[model samples]
Target: MILKRLQSIGMVFLFLFGLLLFPIRSHADSAAYVIDETGVFTSDQLLELNDLAEQVTNDRECGVYVVITKNMHGYSERDFAEGLFFNYDLGYGLKDNPSGIILAIDYNDRFYDVYSYGAAGDTFTTARLDSLNDLVYDYLVKDDWFGACKAFINKCDELLESTGYVYHTIQYTDPTIAPHIVETSPEQRRNEFLLRLPFAALGSSIVGGISVMVMRGRNKRTGLAKNADQYIVNNGVRLTQSRDMFINRTRSVTRIQRDTGGGGHGGGGHSYHSSGGTHSSGGRHF
Candidate 1:
């Protein structure tokens, strides 16, 4: 009984070991690539590309394949052609050879092309191509691989809608004429303001000081003119009131001069006399 129990245990252990080995083999088989001279790709590169491809395919809920061709080979070549094979001679084609999507990276041109076997061909420029690669690296490789791939494909679809496939072309223009940047959220704006607050505050202080100085000079000139006008008006009013009775005295002097014949300026023998009392105006006159 003891021997039988040990044998059963050994069989159980073997079974578990085989179960573990199965996944290892399956993974190895599933991840296959075709590397060649001028392929311009390393094992790590292929692995990364494969990971992105799998992510896109898995999210679409459709079977898709990613194939990289050295010097753009697959564009005009067939899967069964000689010297055309993936890792372990596994052919590079749509899943089950059915109509599907394929993301082909041409290492030679550093350009990427997306082809829907039965639909259309879309191309990406160097910058946009780099953006797609970055999206794969950042989102697919680092974050949710499936979600990133799906989002990328969706973006490609949106691009296609506007300019068909030509939307991938890059526009070179003067940086000064570039469109206004999109506004950021309040939090982002606040952070930006804080980052630039020192310079902004310094500029505001300079402007404010200059404005205050100008206003002060203007007020001083205005006040001086206003005070002089008020003084002149007050003195004129006081003199007029104090000299009201002097008007009759001035008339009497004028009559006396007329009676003494002093009005005849051409008479050489004419004599003029002055009044003994001196009249004074209330305000000093120069």
Candidate 2:
């Protein structure tokens, strides 16, 4: 009995010691600033970038999101960024008037786009975004993923600190502009359709369930009251929710511009619009 007790104590101490010796691992997706879905960065690099991004985002009151994915999710760079931003709620200010920037990179396509919204758009103007893109172009081209991310975070901090960005009251026009002019190949459209079928089925199931419940309720009522206090009590409330599913190959466009923000090497032929808002923006292939 004495020997057994001693061994049990030793095992308990060893477990406690191991707990202190090993580091707790964290899931990368839990990190909001830098989401490396491509898994290219090491733990140390991700930790460093997350620290820097968090610090700067707090200081500037504008979020800096870096999303490096394997592919574009069958959508354009602009749409991917916009959808992720709103869907994930990636901004610093109010929901309606959010302020942030996203550097979305499609690793397989070797393409990247910089998108900014609210005050960040004005702060990171066409000129600023262009210059920012140029700053990371070389690093991306060379496959220096860590260097590119660090440079991106640092450059955003630099621009936000500077006081030269042009700010104007941009009056947004019909944000409903035309669909993408480029013809989406049949193969791409088919892939998008396949992706949406599950959602369509889910919606149909919900609507059918509601209809059946309504019909059953009517059948349960055998006779209607016809005297005093015959009126319905109206004590209970019924709520219904529905969503529209649009599966298409149309690209969103924003042709209006208010401020060019100033001085850059990269040129913008047409301004880009995001899916969630009418923010001023720009983009290009590396």
Candidate 3:
């Protein structure tokens, strides 16, 4: 009975192993092409990156082919640099080169790089170097394929303004100024004037008060001038001195009045006054 129990245990272990292997085999079959150069990447590392690309392309419905060069013989350092130049050049030629994205790894340097060519008008820039590295390492290396591809595309947009690579065409639209200028009928103008009447009356009242103050000041000066002659007679002051004082006070009052009321009226009934006698005054009001 002990021997029979041992046989049963063995059978149970075999069954579990088969179950686990079945899913893995099925997954391997469904994945897109996964090329790994044994010299460049260990079998385990290749499998890991393959699984990552598979998961991402499957989710995003994108065609992804992962190529790994194990030995420098078939894919040397010169070969890789030429490959990048070729891809960039070809993309420029075909104008559709940005669709293919490459994730290249330099095992010697322990660093990886991602190059993407987005749609037309989208080009690469130096500013995106760091972000592209982050997307490849953080997302692609982590098997977040969908996130990596999306982030790559977004990085392209972020680089557009700073890239200095102008697209094929400049999009322009005519300025729409007609909407800003509305044609109002006589009735509308009357209504607009009525709407502004209260403010206009307030402004007029202010102006009238200012005018009254100015007139009162003039009247005071006139009275002072009349009394100046009396002072000259009583205090022995000169007539020339009295006349000069009256003229200077009148000139000051005129300047103040001009400063308070000299600009055009607009939608608002507030008057805009300028301090300078010349048209190019220091202040302006609308």
1 or 3, greater by TM-score: 3
Best-first order by TM-score: 2, 3, 1
Residue-level lDDT tens digits of model 3 in 52-137: 65554434323233433322223333234224322223222223222333444443333344443322223332234445556556
Best by TM-score: 2
Task: Report clashes for each candidate as comma-separated counts.
Answer: 1, 1, 5
* Model 3 Cα RMSD, 1 decimal: 34.1
For every model shown, what is its TM-score relative to the native structure? 0.25, 0.52, 0.26
lDDT of 1 by residue, 1-286 (tens): 9999999988996786566445544554645322223444455655665565455434433223444444434333222111122222222234322223334434444433433321122223334434544554444334343344445555544444544432111112221212212333232344455556557656877998999999888877533343556466544755335433544433333433346534322423312111101111110101
Tens-digit lDDT track for model 2 on 1-286? 9999999988996786455333222222357788777788997888899899999898888888888877776676567665455544577766555678888787888888777766677577767777878888889888998898899999999888885443232323334323332333333355456556557757877998999999999888678657855464676445587788989888899989878776433434324344323322445566
Which stretch of 10 consecutive residues in model 3 shows the poorest summed lDDT?
Answer: 276-285
Off by over 4 Å in 3: 1-34, 39-45, 61-66, 70-98, 108-112, 118-126, 134-286
> Which segments of model 2 are wrong by more than 4 Å?
1-29, 164-286
User: Which candidate achieves the best lDDT against the true structure?
Assistant: 2
